[model samples]
Target chain A: MRVGVVTFPGTLDDVDAQRAARVAGHEVVALWHGDHDLQGVDAVILPGGFSYGDYLRAGAISRFAPIMTEVIAGAQAGLPVLGICNGFQILVEAHLLPGGLLRNDHRKFICRDQTLRIENTSTAWTGAFAQGQEIVVPLKNGEGQYVADAETVARLEGDGRVVARYVDVNPNGSVNDIAGISNERGNVVGLMPHPEHAVEALTGAGTDGLGFFTSLAGVLA
Target chain B: MPKPEILDPQGKAVLGALPRLGFTGVTDVRQGKRFEIEVPEVTEAVLAEIAKMADSLLANTVIENYTVRVEQDA
Candidate 1:
């Protein structure tokens, strides 16, 4: 499968994401945030970054990028999309996913290897993992707290759309320890951890995050 | 500012520092952004447009609450 990775002006993780896709046996397609075309890739990954310098709130400006128009439309039409860290913020800003990512409750930029429980494995990017499986990946961000209204939170929990939850400790004070979640259809997923950063054992903390990229094979098959 | 349902750590930090600085009697502090927009004229429609902008870009309604005040022609 061909996976497209988007590079916004201030994007910091596009290269890592593209490398992860390539390592997962998918053709990597470079996508520009300023361009409207998706290049007809089967899947898309919005990598971590401080896009637009995190000005006017993280991901708020990048949500209006020319490429997001196509991404939003394609995601709505069941095109698979995975958003990581800042990409998750963009997904929320675009209203493709519910809730918002706020500043960490501790008011610090935290970087650590976090353990996450896969709560729902039906999503396009998480199908490789078993339900309730624990995986370790790097979590780094300032605005990583996930927040939503009471009703939305209840609905997400009720529908079993929560894809991952922080294990051992809630690093960012995300609501209900939610580390990641998927849209109702399970095609679009927004995860706060840097899965792309964990695709390699030599450089990353572990190879646990490789499943996020490899799962697309089953999804596209 | 963060909505009532959301936690505002920045505001809490300000509140904590206020008491340490010998200032008291202030109950709360909520850090928020203030955008000074220069428009041709302040009208009902203009205010509505500004509200739309606030809802769309200026503030994220999910965790934030924003208020627009018209500072006429200044």
Candidate 2:
């Protein structure tokens, strides 16, 4: 399986994501935000960053990028797409995911080793984790707070679409302590944390995030 | 949707500073941006368009809410 990591302007984690995919036994493809082509990759990863310098909202301008027309089209057609951090914001701005991310309630940028529990391991991006498994990943962001109407939050929980939940502390006051969520089909998942950063012990903590990439390999197989 | 009242730190800062300048008995303050959108005319259709822009772009919709006010140029 070839996992394409999209490189957007100011994208900080595309290379790291590419390496994570490669280490998980999948070929890595470098996808560009300005290109309309997806390069025929089986899956796409929208890496973390301050895309377009967070102008007009975090993911606002990036959604209109040429690559997204194809990315959104392919995602709607059931292609597996994982959005991490700013990529998660892009997903919501692109209307590929419901709800929106807001500034942290306390109005501060936070960076730390964060613990998250697997709430729904059925998504294409999270299948490698056991149900309710706790994992630690590095989380860094300013506008990582996830928010939505009460009904939408209830529906996501009712349908078991929440893929991950923050454990110990609510890092950014995300509703329901949701660290991540998946689309109805589970092919599209978005999370506001730096999972790719935690893929290796040398760079980050224990390789708990390797499972996200490996899960895609499992899905493609 | 009615936006839940979350304390606006920026707005509070302005509220605190105003009293030092001799303005008295101010109960509250919620400072926000005001944009004068230039439209051809103040029609319901144009006001609706401005409202849409406010909802989708100008306002964050999560922490901050916005209201669109249209006034015709004399």
Candidate 3:
């Protein structure tokens, strides 16, 4: 499988995401924000960063980027798309996912090794994990709080669309401690933690994050 | 403005400081953004257009709502 990592202005995790895909035994493709082409990759990962300097709002400006037009269409056609951290913001802004992320309740930027429970393993990104398994990944963001209307929240919970959840502690006051979610088809996933940063034991957080990248093989199988 | 259910930390912080400054009687405070657009003319169509822009980009409907108002030059 070939994985494409998109780089928007101020994006800081594209290289790490590409490396993670490579480590997972997949060829890596680089995608750009200014281009509308996906270059024929099997999957796309929107990595973390302060895109457009988070102007107007986190992920607001980047929602209109040239690449997003293709991403939105491709995602609708069942392309596997993973959005991490700032990428998650863009996904919500593009209405690819329900709800929205707002400033953390504490009104501060938080960075730490966060524990998240894999709540759903059927998604394209989480298929490698066992049910209710806990994994630690680096979570860093100021506008990381997840919010939604009462109806949307209930629908997501009832449909099992929530893919992952914060465990032990909710760092950003996300509703239901939601750390990640997946679309109805389980092809599109958006998560607040930086799994790409945890792909290697050399990075100090262990190899848990590699599952996200490796899950592609099982998804395409 | 942020939805009634959404927590507004910035407003909370401002509320915390008001009593210390001797301005007591303020019940609550919510911080929000205001945008002033200079349109060529303030028609119903123009206002509706601006409202649409606010809906799509100027505000995140999930967390905030916006209103467009026209002011006459003094």
Best model per lDDT: 1
| DockQ-based CAPRI category assigned to the predicted complex of candidate 1 | high
Better of 1 and 3 by DockQ: 1
Error at A213, model 3, angstroms:
0.7
Q: Relative to the unseen true structure, what is the C-alpha lDDT of residue B26 in candidate 1, on a scale of 0 to 100?
A: 96
Taken in order, the candidates have interface RMSDs of 0.9, 3.6, 1.0
Off by over 4 Å in 2: B5-74
| lDDT values for all models | 0.94, 0.87, 0.93
Tens-place lDDT per residue, model 3, A177-204, is 9999988999999999988999989874
For each candidate, report its DockQ versus the true two-chain complex: 0.84, 0.28, 0.76
Q: What's the number of clashes in each of the models?
A: 0, 0, 0
Better of 2 and 3 by DockQ: 3
Error of 1 at A135 (Å): 0.6
Arrange candidates by lDDT, highest first: which order?
A: 1, 3, 2
Per-residue CA lDDT of candidate 2, range A1-221, in tens?
99899999989999999999998989999999999999999999999999999986798888889999999999999999999999999999888988888777666899999999999988999999999999999999998889888888899999999999999999888989999999999999999977788888898877998899999966867
| lDDT: the better of candidates 1 and 3 | 1
> Chain B TM-score for each model?
0.85, 0.75, 0.91
